[model samples]
Target: MTDPTYEFSRAITRRPAASITDGLRAEDIGTPDLGRMLASHAHYVETLKKTGAEVIELAPLESYPDAVFVEDTTLCLPQGAVMMRPGAPSRMGEVAEMEPTIRGVYDEVRQIAGPGHIEGGDILVTGREILVGRSDRTDAAGVTELTEIVSDWGHTVREVFTPPGVLHFKTDCSLLDGETILSTKRLDASGCFEGYRVLHVAEGEEAAANSIRFNQFVLAPAGFPRTTEMLRQNGYDVVEIDNVECAKLDGGMSCLSLRF
Candidate 1:
């Protein structure tokens, strides 16, 4: 059975603004750069189609560029969509805005509530367990809530501590398939995933190693030549997109959009 939490007919993302970083001059966020970003995103849209996934492109709302899409944070279990409360204050509004669209996509949708934050970027699923990262964005309370919420669906939840430096769980880990996983020493593997199988990428691929799986939509940044090849070698075709604009502020394929 397809894991009820994973699906890939359609995905969603917020349109970015001319500049992602604050205080940066318009020249720094020039038209050419923005154009490159858009073209790259368009490539991503096409790549999703290659995996038989459809795109649900959302028009920008007042053009707030910092909103890390809550769409991904809201995971779809067999029960419903659990809308995560984002840890970032500037991004809290995004969850509210995305609920209506999500409801249209799934009949039953739920919320992850405030004071307990969870960001989609920090969660990864294997065939059996939902690995959650307890980080600056997704706090202790947030993981607890997730554990309880998903337990009802018969899915086990496990916690991985985010090294103080990394911002998200996925920044250091990604799933290649049901049993294989690509992660980094930065994650302190033996400490978190005691008995699971893991492949540790070299230092260079740490950031690029974090990719999101949407059906066959394997989302990763434009770089990662070696890591991409490794994935391809493992029988998974890969899609690389330019997230230069989004990357400036720690965004990537997974952060920019939510797939369902």
Candidate 2:
């Protein structure tokens, strides 16, 4: 049986633009190298295609430096797609750019249409519920609006808290399967994942927590060896993609694509 939460038939990704050097970051680690980012991105898209999924590769939008992080623009659920309103002023235009593509894929598409803000990076859909984290990018009003929107589709949204200093909720956690979650120990200490099976990433390898379970494989950032081995011993087919360029801008495995 296919698990709607992690199993997907298609995915959407955008190529990193030359302007990615200007992408938003909490701190300036270094300017992202567009050539290196493109090579790594090609590998990511190739891995997805290997799973027999139709991967939609969108052209780079030079006007939007952060457009490559497409997952922030919309949440693609089994019932429909909901375009998010990003709290970051610079990111608000991304949703409009993603709307037409989302509409083409889903017969039913909804918009937040809010003064509130939410981003797909702050959400995680499990077998029984949808967990939304309150972060700098996702607010209480955004959670409330999302709850009301999905309730009609029979989904229960649980408002949770993102770890302090985290970019997004999923930055410190990810759904591994229907009942299991891969999370950072710091985030798990808050007890947000209670009632669910949790696996902590190896200390200092917390970035691996943002990995994605796509079809039959787990796509993870390449430099986290310990975390990769841990997932491997647990029966996951792991694929590590070079993430150095993206990391310079605070991006990770889950940030690159929108799967459904």
Candidate 3:
């Protein structure tokens, strides 16, 4: 079999803070149960380990309510890693906390300096191209800076407009493989993924779009059966885990871990 384009050997994640129930959420969803969120996070870390990745679980930052979603702080790539400046002022400190961890693993690491805000969730690395989404958490300036940084690594950066209702680009879509994407119908219609093949999430299962394809299996949230079936029918080995509490905080499978 051919090697997968986005396989990873290491990953980073953070424990959910006791303040996790205060995380930023678009809707008025009830607070997530901290105990349940922690359990789910532990399960996520375990799953990452099962993928043969050396999972680094960072201590939770009670001050940063949204820090559990570590994927928003930096983008880890084979070339190196990029520490981001989150557009949300409350999330800015997460970058500083994530830098040392990233530096430990990458010989060459870069930072998206201020006046330019970007979030890892808005960046997707697929083969030779890096697709960045222009969202509330990521602006054009951020994308421009990111493009310049990754260009040195021989990557072509393309900016895509994230839909209005989405919190981040990856919230509506994810890279399933080098040439295929798992996306919500709304995002697929946004014309951002013109050249790639898209597998639309089942109707009413939009959250399922935010999934990750680890080394050998696809990590998807439980309770989205239709979407799960779609993945199975496409020949992927799927591992479903309960993410009820995380979902309440606008977090998903991909948001919990940063793989490289």
For every candidate, C-alpha RMSD to the true structure in Å:
3.4, 0.6, 1.4
Which pairs of residues collide in candidate 3? none
Measured against the true structure, the TM-scores of the candidates, in listed sequence, are 0.86, 0.99, 0.97
Candidate 2 residue 159 Cα shift, in angstroms, is 0.6
Best by TM-score: 2
- Which candidate comes out best when scored by lDDT? 2
Expressed as tens digits, the lDDT of each residue in 170-232 for candidate 3 is 889888888889999899897888889899999999999889988888899999999999999
RMSD from true fold, candidate 2: 0.6
In model 1, state the lDDT of residue 134: 83
Question: Which portions of model 1 miss their true places by more than 4 Å?
Answer: 3-7, 23-32, 68-73, 188-190
Candidate 2 lDDT tens digits, 142-189: 999999999989999999999889999999999889999999999999
Candidate 2 Cα outliers beyond 4 Å, as residue runs: none
Per-residue lDDT for 18-55 in model 1, tens only?
A: 54444122134432356676777777777777767677
